[model samples]
Target: MKLSFLIKSLAGAATMVAMAGPALAAAQSAPSPVTLKGDVMLEKIVTENGVSKTQLVEPKVVIPGDHLLFTTRYHNDGAQAVTNFVVTNPLPSAVALASESAPGTEVSIDGGKTWGQLGSLKVTGTDGASRSATAADVTHVRWTIPTIAPGASGEVQYHGIVR
Candidate 1:
């Protein structure tokens, strides 16, 4: 009898709490509003040597149909060191990549700005001329990495089909 009474009391308490306040109702209906406010101000430091460079470190060119294994290396010359950086390469309009490497690096089909994975980039029409990236499209190019460690270097290479 005592156990049964305890359970009933708990259930009654729960129902009362549920109906007791707007906070509970709001939490159940939708997540409670959240406000986050903070700021970290740091003086910007500019150094002559703080420069980032991306270059084709290896073989510049390859045969038209051959796999042009071009490796691009990025260097961080900044004293403070940079982190969580992404490296990208845009494929020129005239040329397309080989079958094994049709999708080029960071080549946003939508334009030449945003980049994503190869499979995500859409080729609407293969009619070469008709097949083009438009503003409505969200074509992404292959990014070297999702993130790069500070003061570190990374490389990415891909083949292209010479037009």
Candidate 2:
């Protein structure tokens, strides 16, 4: 299946905002101090000179079980520092989160309505039963950046597998 659609959907759904205080909230009409960019890549293993290396390449198409990497890059464009910056990315229904997320990353299994560590979250099935959420159950991934200095840029990433 072509994964470009999934990637595009994810990029559009990803959000980055500064968790400002009431005073700053009043200035919401003003330009944001932080800018965000999102991308998705397909993971591939290539062999050269009898050595194998994993590479992240732009995703064109993907098959079930293919590994994908999702990343969000943030930059502080304002003159002052930005505090309590949060970045959140919603996963596409075609993908299932794979392995452990980055350290300090919080996950949401309920469509971003609630957030917590994967181990601490729960999911309700159609059968009216609740089960501990797993990586595959993650609907969103987030990272809380305490501070981002002027002109500073950084990125956060997570892994997923095509469903």
Candidate 3:
């Protein structure tokens, strides 16, 4: 009877460890908390006839040198607060900022891949295509918010000049 109890206890312990393996692995691999927020959220405001809708009403496509306005909002839903963290988005090839919003945001002269301050980030990509990511291929708007607290949100509106 004693031997049987010992065998059963060992088997139960092994089972418990197997069940907890994933939790242990995640704890070990987790990154340390920092000022940067953990999770980011994006949403588009759709309106059939509203002026401030996420969905583009007027045709986004335009002739070269023509400009169109675009808007997008982002929310922080993570446990951390984001400060001086850059937000980047790709604009349609045929768009560019006409003017901009009150609080000016950075525009990356390079494509939408990397971002920087109000200036631009230098890019060096192997793609030789004209639309490839490059410092000269400004197709994005970037901004560093003061602090995007968890559950807080921000927005960006800009112009797109059709190439």
**Each model's TM-score, in the order given?**
0.41, 0.75, 0.41
| Whole-structure CA lDDT of model 1 | 0.48
Clash totals, every prediction: 5, 0, 8
- TM-score of model 1 relative to the true fold? 0.41
Off by over 4 Å in 2: 1-29, 48-52
Compared with the true structure, all predictions reach lDDT values of 0.48, 0.87, 0.57
Judged by TM-score, which candidate is best?
Answer: 2
Task: Compute the lDDT for candidate 2.
Answer: 0.87
| Root-mean-square deviation of every model | 17.3, 14.4, 10.5
Alpha-carbon runs more than 4 Å astray in model 1: 1-63, 99-107, 113-115, 126-151
lDDT of 2 by residue, 4-40 (tens): 9988777666632333455577878588889999889
Q: In candidate 2, which residue pairs get closer than 3 Å at backbone N, Cα or C atoms, i.e. clash?
A: none
Candidate 3 per-residue lDDT, tens place, 20-51, comes to: 99999998877633323222222234557666
